[model samples]
Target: MALSLDTIGPDTKNTAKGRLEPAMPPENRLEMPTQSLGRWSASQERKPVVDRSRWRTYLARLFVFGGGLILTGYGTYEMYQVVSVSRTTVLQWLLVALFTVNFSWIAVAFTSALLGFFALLSQSRGRGPLPTTLSCRTAIVMPVYNEQTSRTYAALEAIHESVEATGLGAHFDYFILSDTTDPEAWIAEERAFLALRQRLGPQARFFYRHREKNHHRKAGNIADFVMRWGGHYEHMLVLDADSLMTGECIVRLAAAMEADPDAGIIQSLPLIINRNTLFARLQQFAARVTGPVIAMGLSVWMGRDGNYWGHNAIIRTRAFADQAGLPDLKGRPPFGGHILSHDFVEAALLRRAGWDVYMLADLDGSYEESPPSLIDLSARDRRWCQGNLQHMRVIGAKGLKLPTRQHFATGIMSYLASPFWLFQLIVGIALVLQTTYIRPEYFARDFRLYPIWPRFDPERALALFALTMGILLAPKIFGTLLMLLRGHERRASGGGIRVVLSSLIEIILSALLAPILMLIQSGSVFQILLGRDTGWQPQRRDDGSIPLRDIVRRHRWHTVLGLLSGISAFMIATSLFLWMSPTILGLLLAIPLSWLSGQLGAGLALKRLGLLRTPEEFRPPAIAIRANELQQRNATFGYDDQDGLLSLYCDPELRERHVEMLSPTSRRKRGEIETDRALAEAKLGDAETIEDVLAWLKPKERIAILKDPALLTRLVGLKSGTSAIKAAE
Candidate 1:
């Protein structure tokens, strides 16, 4: 909370406060000294990294499973009766009954499935020998644009040290891809980069390149590198400005890739370990604890052609180059010139070309930072949502095959899952109608000997119920088992039995929060689909948490609905008295859900009570901190200092105006362009020589101006000094 200042100030000042890495180039170019892919004599399809069966077989199974689920759902829904509301007594009861049985199955099963998947992955981690052979050259690209050079390099240094420990450090190179425009910061980056290279020596490579004209945002930044130096390396591992990974995991991924030659990509599921904010911590914990099973199930299904998040992933460079050229969707924001969300598209493209993309859930030592607040994550999601929606264009693209279709569907699912929440509202209304109106048989005179049960057919009910259980609950059940088997439930989780209990509580709380998020996400999706534009807005990177007021304000609608549901349940269940009170009381559960959207969640509770501390387990190594520049070096004319931070000793526009002030030749033109400050700052009467003009300035500044001699040569003052005297005559 105390560190929130610099990240939240006015945009201009925030930019100013962060020290910029020194200038490398205005035009960003990613050039490496290594040989191109075309230059290599080795087969482009060589299997140096991944074992073929593990990669390819996984891909085949995932598609079959996902495709089967989609097909089954559509088939079952089509066969079911389409209800037309009619006042007929039996028909209305049937409609309400149908809604209760089917809808609950879908909702409950989905939750169960999520839990089961994590269990499966935890189990997988304990059993398998992770791929460890190091045969591929992987370039870890860290793309930075006006970020803190010290912290960025520190994180990179931490990773570099981790990498050396793996003994495969020679296989990986670090690229500090600078996109900063500030001359001083640019210079700082250059100096830091050089320092890092010196420390890393030959095994660890450091590259510094700049782009003067930034066009395509982050995607284009990487694309530029692909075009320039992409051919030199076999694969590229991407990290954001704030991303960090352990060296051992890096080697493991490479080993996995080498062990399986067919693997086109390996996506490392990142854990957020540094976040202290409420919004992020919730996301971080959910991702860390709840994540493994889902990732495991996903890994189980998606052997190859899995999701490719923009960061913490390794890509086969040659295959990517040959197949990953993303066609610009012609239009405005959301559906823009360059693909904003190009990772999925690229993955799909690679798969279409018969390459395998794998999601490695078992790997660790990879870490990523999170947005400190809700508004921040939402802002980031807005861009992603729009970009994924654009992938709809690629779904129909001629050659992509079935895997691409499924991948695109997965992308849409990222935001579209919210719409399904609307179904719950419909089901809840049906629950009210059925309970209140359809009186239980013999409710008036229930004999002690036998009570009549509400009737629905056993076979139809059982079939639908089985499918629902398999799809939803199975994943969660599997996850729990995985953790137990892997021994992580006892080892990794600091809370012994207490941690498992906490996780269960977290899951239940998260489930209620889901509906509320569903509402928000659904609306956000609609806005994008309707052509609303989002931006490359920076996410909040501070440690300060979300406020409770924000939660209440944002999710109040859920609270209102919850109260209404509770009330409606009571009125219906009154006939059954306290027997039905629990169902009705579920409405009061909304209060906790609403609070979760605020600071009352475990994230904030942990920070306050120091209960769920993530520990200071994550930080960059000392070498990285020392190697990165704290003070920016300024350019002192002559040789443009590679290590110098660039500060404008003179603005060309300002100098040009001064030139006009010196001349009688362009006096009218000069006055038109000059600002009041420049005019006020201007001194008209000078002793006339360059030396005389230089006398008015401070020693360092004056010498700086003189150091660039051509500046004196081209000044309008000298050009028109003789002209001014002639004109006076």
Candidate 2:
């Protein structure tokens, strides 16, 4: 596909004075052909071969995975002893198996944290210096779905300013690759694009393109750009809608790519920022405090075979176009279609093709936002769960390395662990119920010397529980200790005492929230396993407040289950009730806990008292502040406030720009009809006024009308009332 630079109007003689047409940057074409999953050339030559067998990588992997296995073995034996006071029943054996799986999961984390803690102490946590210049051009692209145009565009503007400040701005081009399906959002983006370009002037290399068909979602959006314009640049820095990075970081990343000819993708660790709601703040704190340790550990072991997290990463354009074309999995829906989690697969494919994929653990200035509420988080998690679960198919694709496969396995287990934990809990409860209520088989049919008793070694079980908790908390502990030891970090986070208090608060809150999330994820896993698909949806990105009735309605079942389980545990034994207290408490308070998750007041009150205060919150980054200011300024312009039809109806120049930017529609075949288009045409023909069309048109019909030039021309000719489409109902 050869995309041409679109210059809207060559003749501006009749134009209003001082008015300028929105001109897009000339397209630098590239061809990105899709690659096959089942076929690849093993003998293909590359500049640099990634040495997975390097001693450091080998030793790191050995320490992490090998240590996890050794710990799992010891933990399994202790669990067996706790359960096997006598002849082990099926339930006891199953419990031990579950224990082994769950134990190994944390054991890996514990081992990784140990390695990361030492690595951090020894290594400097900084990219040496920003490069003064770069010889190669890079495209900084952000793919937007049905997101708020103000926020997304504002972020781009801020990044643009930051990049220009580095004096390397000429080497970078910015593209807003929009996959927006929303009619209003589509126009709003165009309006913002024009206004933003005008503000930045003609010399700024900013462009916008909206896909007619949002095929394959985000991956397709990016692939479309790569196929059309990727060849212009040596590398592409992909950013999420919520992603923000400093000029130094962007320049450094491009320089790093220039320095390493074999580097395919270098992912940066993005810390969460600008969150005010309690759940978002909790996440922000946790990611700031402990996320680095975990990320550093993954970097140590992953080495050149690291994973891409979809955004905040720079990819070599040629390598991605050649090797990372994702193949659709066979079958249907969640598992059979286009890959949802394309980043990990892309990284693996690049590695399979002998390109080095890396994670720059020390890289900073990359940042992103978290979902503001539990419900919002769960909604996002559902899509992620389905995506990760889909990896089960691709893990076996030809030519993937063992570590790449391990990455796949780890992703799969991340979601699967929830179900495993839930099942283990249920089985543990069942064991207790049997012991308390069901009669035990005393004498065997063979006439055993003594009667068998259904019992666990209380002391050993308690010790095992302690060990499990220790392992689970090790990463957080290490993170806290590191913060306290570093004077700058300690002072930034409100001193050692406040840091300790905040960590404690985070630990307690996370403990309370874990059970709820476990149940949510477990349900998602079951749904995906049953062949259910989680469709794409735009995440809510503001203060995620919910109505009282909605909160109760959502969490009532959880509360009831918690109550029943608590009652049963108490009825079974005091020890059992005590053991299950955390889970029970979390589930029982699900409604209020969920409400608190979105409460800005609670989060702010804590902020005032210096609890959950991240270093970023104390010293706000200039880029973040500028983005927020631009967002507010953009909001005031009412670009996002107007409906698509009304915006076009009101502004003739915008309508012209919109029509010019639309990709030429293909000719329909004989007997072919677009359902939405047909419906939209019929409605447009019947409509007497713009008000009538706005009142009667469905969302799909609106989109269809917006896309059809003829229909939009008719919509433009409609009689209007004194007022346009109202922003409020």
Candidate 3:
């Protein structure tokens, strides 16, 4: 597993004329391993065997799932009995069906949480010792889109330093895989990378590669890395731009992968961190307290048939390449083309090939950031909604394990349940309107003991409602109690009283926010159904406060709808109005709610009051602290505001590095016009100075000029007062 530093060096060479030349062919210049490296050894192959332990796991899952189904059935029957006590009409039956579907969703979550709670209670708190040495070469890959260059490289540097501290640095290599589209971002990434390498010294095993075309976005970025350089490593630990992991966690994952030859992927549960906005902090706290129990429960039942979250996980590189080559779905965008949610599908494919996918839920020090605002979260969720819905096409694919299919179903339901709940609410309102305004059938074709009345048994309905609320709230109660019982966690989360109070505040806020999310998700589902695609967009990770006007513009419709609904409900019945108050209030206050969600002052106030405090917040981890420090240090002028053309014109070293990083352009067919290059060349010929060319060309045109060798050479010469026409020729 010893890594050789001989092959790792700067890719720039100086020619006799002092012009920079690419040291290697463009295909091999981006720090990729040579193609002569062998694939994973045969001994690493996973063998499928019928282990009796799988049966036990299945039985446990069956028991938990079966119990949930049974409970849901009884609840549905009780509701049906109450509805029938008045009158069983078509509308009533539809209400019953909607109620059953929506209730079942919660029922499954309740059961899963119940199992997770018990699992947490039974498990030992102590982490097992890590192996002193590792025998496999692992690559830590962080895939970046148009993300902040400083933050990404800073996080990587922190992780590298942490791993080196563990005294096993040579066995692992770090990669920053960039698929950035913006020319400014591309340049920024290269600058940051070179700086990071220099800071870490030449012996440090850090490499970077930028792709010309994004292809399938994040999934494609990783795939390109695998196809080109995956052969050199036994394992690859994939990470997102916002991901940060401790050295100990990284080492343990690698050691665990080496120890278990049959395992294909081992996922670590990543908690949210570095959040200051009220909404972000709330999400962070919930993930800290409730995420582990839920994750552990899934792990307990999933055993060998587990899921991958795409990042913060270690995987058997060969198994992934062999089994998880993603296919373009049948047709175009949205549900077709490239798979958006590739992680789940990859996990399923690995399991189909008999490779075990596991979740190490107990592993700590894995962290990620949340969206800074509710609006930002909605944007991210829209993409996720489309991705999850796209799973409908893959769920029935042949050879998938039953548990894998279940995982797919669970993901699909996560988005679908929002719309289902919205539909149920609409149906209930319609039924109430019909009962109040429309005439009910006094008699039916069938014989009846008495005339049918479209009225529900209030007492029975109240009891059923109470039961549903209890089940829905049980998980939070369980999580709270568990945290209280654990002395370390309890103290870390302020006192028990503060924890309970924070939980209560969180619950109230969640209740207020739930309806807003439901409406937003419903709209997203409708949009997706109508063939509107959500393209890949970078998430907003920093907690800068959102403008009030922007919040109002986004939520104006919600407020109007809330007013109308409240008026209608009150006109129908006082009981209906009272029942719908929570929803109405949330909707009516949507703008303010969203505005406050992104407010830093409010979040800080809560922090100062010792509310919503997580263990990480109270005592920050070393890796997190180091990452923050590096981020502050690495902050520089934003790429977008600076002139891309002038940047290269000013710095000779940067210009050379930029040229070395550009992928060699493909040869054009005869008579095929390079429109961008043609326009860029024309602009360069007309310009007298760098400022003239910068003013004449747009962002895309400028990027084109930089990418083309001839165009860039001409632009550089013109900046030095040379003849642009001769340089172009």
Candidate 4:
């Protein structure tokens, strides 16, 4: 047999392949690693595990982080206390009455706090009621193409098995909803769904549908499902390809829907729990632990008003259909295209129509696997940015209520949260210094020494500290108690010292990651707002280690921002740091923290020392038992070898390896055009349908290809349309 990496390729770490080319050039990419390709040495190919000596190994970061959390909790409490007191006792002699009035300051702070409070309440601990009788015959929808049906089906089957295990599987159905453009993958999905249907018998209803036209990508595929089979059920539960929620949670979502007929949507916080690479592992750990506090806080605050994330949520059919009609954009690509981020707007629409949208906080067993690497996460975010930005158009459209506007505003600002935080933190430092160093002012009610503007009276400081600590720590206490009250912590947290310690460790890591992420998300959000795009890229779905150069390439701007941020902090706030050592240290740590934000340094170091190795024990049992079957992912990519392979084509390990093995040079020679074209055509074979032919087009230029050669060829074959294909091959 020829050296064919066309199957899983040489970079066979996880199901989703990794890089097959040289590191992305700095000019073309941002927020990537430094030494990208060489990071994953041959010996490091495996999955992530809890560092047994995690303490021993990551000891330096652990103590630094644990100490940092204490400082954050303590300092934020103190800092906010200062702000609250100052806000209440307005300065007497002020140059600007606007500053004295604190109009915008109070407006934004209370607005954020108010919104935060609402968001907090929305993640309430209590379940409204469980369904005594299943009112809605549900269909849990999973869509996939040639990409990775096995992983998709596996997650679907796991969820199905989980539901069946509950004995309520009969009320629920499974749809392997596909917009797959590949014959092999689509055929595999058909066979798999049939097998699943057979295996489940009548315990569960299983259906598989693949659209001949995958017009709107995910949204289009889903709309097709609703248009066709939606009427059969009152509600539908949707899952992304990488999403896997345990059985009990799906049942709970259904039950919640049944219990509350007025509830238009109930979204489970689809947190990431398991991943293999260091980046994915860190994210997964953070989501599982910090997620509850943040989620519960938001849910408690949001109450019956919440935005819908695209998947891992249950939605009411009639309500969504009635209110959530999406109109195509007339503008340019990216934003003007179809509504990419449809979940939030649909939720907003549902609420506008007077239905409740709830986000359940501690809905146990709701889980998902993380994007296996940082590169994957960034790619997904790019698509989401485009989708969510499209909603900016819907914000001002008539008929949306105040709460609906709140949701939309929240959605738009969520991406900008990072940018906002970055600006606030920088300005906050400046304001802090001005207050201390600038000339003191006499306030209306003060006595002794004339205090600074918005005077940092110590009493005011204490109260803010207490209030903030309560807000931040309350969720942890609340989540722990609820689980303990439910008597499920042992199962939920993994029990004993290991679980408790893990939770603490997770919190610390999360804190370190936050500011860095704040920068990334800010850049991402603002870039979207500015119409500077991070395009639709697929995630890294495997356990391969990333090279340093890769990190530098992807995230150079981050490096630049971190270095600048740290330098500024040192320059302007040198005195304040000496006053508050911890805060100063935290501020100073921005450089290294930003550098290692993705745990890029740690991952590299781990691989070098054989510390970050993926353990076999962590591999899914399915992969071990069905090794041959698992590795037999003959899923063809929906790509054309024409135009020297688009970015994503070379992104996947399998395709990249195939290209390398097929031809050593990444670039194809001009004279070999006919030869390679023949090879590519041979691989395409006779595309079963014109749709398959189109899926392989330069995905970015999908619209431009309407007047394409292949389409003309098909039209010529039709003998009914004008235009002809010149190729006789």
Candidate 5:
């Protein structure tokens, strides 16, 4: 009666030729979930009322956005006036347009940050008190690809323990949904799942499933679960491999959902943690400091029409199933095909169906990690760039809310803005070149009182540049001031002076890294435009150091481009060279910058110096500490290098567990050719031992053999002593 992994046993009642059959009924099988096969009707759902506060939010946005546009327009007019004193040619007009576009991007950011600062300052108190126990079942699902089994399972175990501590553990179930492709990784996940079950004991409400085909990747993985077991649970909490949430936060989210019937999804703000690399540490500091202010502003403006960040959020299972069934887009990849960035689109769909999506900005104890280096970050950015660009197709989808379209537009612009900035720089250089080199045709067109001189008022230009820099850096200034105002946070960050010093260092580093990111993102945009598709790959989470040669290979082009641009600017004018010095310097040092970004020693040295210290790093949260402890405990059991077939052949219990977890395939039509099964059978017949099987079979053949029950039977009957072992050697 005790709940355990083994209790969910194989079908003992049914057998075919003495082989055990799957225990579950056909409808309840792992592969087949009862699906509601039809388009969800919007007319049946009650429409959501517009929030009254939206009027005030709209007014605020208009004042801020309109003021920014007016300011940028004035700046553009001044630049035009400066160019008009000289020959007003096509080149000058192009420069004006570029400047306006680039300036508007930053102007909007500045105003948003200013609004965010006010919102943070005016935030109200906590969400009253916790409710007494009474709720529907919630499943906490962690969908994984090829990842380190120890870390992922350890995080899950820690989370399970945290939730159990709250006395609400019985109301929740845990699932490890794997889409792992690598055979080794797949076996490792099974081993880890077993180990986790043992550690938690028999009654632990934990389950694991590995798909034969990844299908539509992650979206498909979740959909498979929803269609199958989703009928049992009222709500589902989604977590990434690296995600960690405290029990209090989880309980609060569930209680809030129960209180609001119209709520479809609720998102929590996840802060970065456990990062040691220099780049990662800097990112952690910035995210911890400035992320809250921006989130508060967004929450105030968006209200119930917010966004989902894919993880660290909970969704109403029925609402998501009925409303968020995504259809494939038309045509080929990089534009058409399956949705890569599915979370945003899901949120839009839910909203379009009259369900409210909200974000809890003030909620704490939610945590995640960042990539360790600039190169790693850029690699991840490449996938995101492609995904965001694909949203142009979805932005025009029928019945989507206006704010949802804006969200899609914002995602698209986050990548496009980089190329815009780069183009602006190129155009500015061209304008300077024309002014300094080409002679003004004073008498060619219309008669003039004086010969036109291509020139700018240097003092006014310098003042304008100063204003732009101030606007761009104002968010950092406000974030720092806010931290200093709070007594506990200031102390946790190593005092006001240290916090101030850290902010300055962060600013300088961010400035140097900006141009490098600009170039990387611009290349990503170019590649996507050229029809290059970025395939899904697991992210590297751990950090130590990267090789110097690898850094050089990745950033060599950036360095070369920097040198060429720097030399060209200097040759044109000292002022132009001076103006471009920051970008040039960042580019010229790209290799070294990237190298230092991944250096653990450099980051630790800063920690020793009391720089870039966050509250979490100083005090260390309970959930984070527990995760590390579990990870270390799990690390002692190392995985075997032998293939899946070899490992399963050696262990009877493992083979049984694996067979029990597989989807029932006995109902396949007669004479249907299973390529894997046929090839596996052919290869197994000629094999003399386990070693022969390993040597003769390819990776695909091995996977096929492992999945087929008949092939596994032959594998288990093979000779298993010193002769077979020696053959393997």
Candidate 6:
């Protein structure tokens, strides 16, 4: 388990006994140039056998889109008949347009789920046998931000151990790429890195790098890795901080890549796991039960032109470096600058270069965690909404494939749908108010045989409503039936009866949560359209309840709006009130529902009742089990709980090691007037003791000092007064 310090640590030529050593692996450089978005040339590699797949893809697309069009047309005609009974009005046309948009959205999904249903019935999970050995090396890179060191490092350790167990560990190496802006989190990452190395032994290929500046966020962190050290490996399997995969799955992905030389990216469908909150468990259940069907449909129809979900996907290093380099768009935040949703763009670029991108839906063992609560989900969705809206600028880029463009449209619509739904509701409400209260215009400028009435045939309206509900709910039914029909899947999801019951519970909960999320997403879209940006924030992984006041503050307006909508609907008609009850009740319960979404006790109660039980909960994966065990052991270090500057000042060894790890730099450029660094230098010069420096330094100043060896040394020279912060204390 031991190795010479010379290979992985700082130079020890003049080192004292008490000095700490650097905990970094040796450098292996690779050049990955930023790609040009304006022009692209297809790769000259041998293409895969795709004649049959091409036909299948065309049929699938035609079936889904054509069927959707047919459904939309029928629904539109029915609405036209209902409204054009006497004469059509402006409000009626608006209603029809909104209805068409909303109906088409679900119609497409309904048709696709039908495709998925049939595909599932006949699809095979067999991928033959795993390759005996690998011909190329892969770098499993996990890009991290300001994250909990213990949880991330523990997950990494588990993944590494799982890979090693397969005896193909020699072909793989792991890297922890950090873009942490938090100084304490940065140091904690280093400490955890060292601990992991010691535990895994020198035979394990583990590396760590922390960026001084988080320029492009995660995309930048990974780009830094690719530019610096990507050449040594044939493929890079990207992992998020919460991602974990089995050794078998890892090897199989590598094998798939090796087998398909045309493949640029191979994405594994990662299911949700290790979640406890009511919201999270609901997500976990839906993903485990229904995700596979949807993914299978996507994979089948998408063929080799599939999209990436950022992480838990393996990419050809050469292909990605050559074609997938992202460019900042023109303009400002929200719609401009560096691409926020880089995964879709990267896939498009790769496909544009004539490389295949595939999503392996049947590949089990890829796992990721979800945001634990409604508030947490809303926070994450805001960022996604902003990112997806930015894709509008990329959709028309030259040389992009049709499917690639469709992917962009789909992403953009996912966020925009919320606002569209809200607008549709408003339009419907306006129509209802006009019918109930507004004076009808009996006279027209032009000669008319009959006067228009702002009313719909109740029978036709009711029939259309039934059809819309069927289209909307078909996918869930398809997924549930598919699960029930399969003995293994049915058993894995609890018994058939329990599975049905759980599906119903998830459906009901989702219905209640939909209106709330709709409002949240609608607001996000509005803000983005107004040129407001949503900055990246770390997701809350634990099932921690938000403050009651915060929940009330967030949902108060939604509650009031719901009440008003209900009152108006009831006044309009009893039928209207009944029709709108789901939406009204959902918005009315937003605050309390949000509160319960994060409650551990409520989620556990459901679990005890055998509801929302994922197969992973029934038979936990070995890697997941190992990860939990290591998380407990690693968390005992409590590195994140310490103050970075104070810990270094009190512990000389850590200070020395911190200095040794900084990239060798000359003096600051003469013309440069960096505010933070300059301020840090001035404060350190004036400080007489450690406490003075601690009190004087801002976060930016602290980061500047932490990155500069000279400033660190100056801080180390400060006096340790009685009031000085100490690591022991």
Best TM-score among the predictions, by candidate number: 2
lDDT of 2: 0.86
Q: Model 5: per-residue lDDT, tens digit, 409-456?
A: 889989999999899789889878977997866675568866665677
Error of 1 at 677 (Å): 16
Q: Order of candidates by lDDT, top first?
A: 2, 6, 3, 5, 1, 4
Clashes of each: 65, 0, 0, 48, 2, 1
TM-score of model 6 relative to the true fold?
A: 0.94
Off by over 4 Å in 4: 1-136, 165-171, 180-205, 246-261, 269-271, 276-286, 293-306, 333-335, 359-363, 373-375, 382-390, 428-500, 564-573, 576-729
Query: Which regions of candidate 2 fall more than 4 Å away from where they truly are?
Result: 1-26, 45-53, 666-672, 723-729
Error of 3 at 106 (Å): 0.9
Q: How do the residues 370-489 of candidate 3 rate in per-residue lDDT, one tens digit apiece?
A: 998889999999999999999998888776778999999999989989889888888888878887888756576787766666778889889998888988887888888899999888
Give the TM-score of each candidate: 0.65, 0.95, 0.92, 0.61, 0.91, 0.94
lDDT of 3 at 80: 97
Candidate scoring better on TM-score of 3 and 5 = 3
Cα error, candidate 1, residue 26 (Å): 16
Model 1, position 680, has a per-residue lDDT of 21
Q: Itemize residue pairs with steric clashes in candidate 2.
A: none
Q: What tens-digit string does per-residue lDDT give for candidate 1 at 1-729? A: 121212111221122222233212233233323212122222333333434456545543545464555645643553242232222234334444544444444443354345345345435234255444566688888988866665677777778777876666888877877666443455446445544554555445666666543567777777777777786778888898877777777777777766666778899988776665555666665666556766765666566657788898888777777767666676776665667788887787666666888787777667777776555566677787888888776677655546568778767766766655455345545544664576655542635343333333335545654665465545444544444454544345443454455456556555555555555677778898787777665455556545666756655665676567566656666533343333333334544444443343446666554333332222333333333332122122111221120111122322332232221321234334434223222422443543344334433333223223333343334322333323422
Off by more than 4 A, model 3:
1-46, 49-52, 446-450, 636-641, 665-672, 720-729
Cα displacement (Å) at residue 305, model 5: 1.2
lDDT for 321 in candidate 3 is 79
> Between prediction 1 and prediction 3, which has the larger TM-score?
3
> Candidate 4 on 521-572: residue-level lDDT in tens?
7666767667764544445565555566776566566556555655655666
- Candidate 1, run of 10 with poorest lDDT: 642-651
For candidate 3, what is the TM-score? 0.92
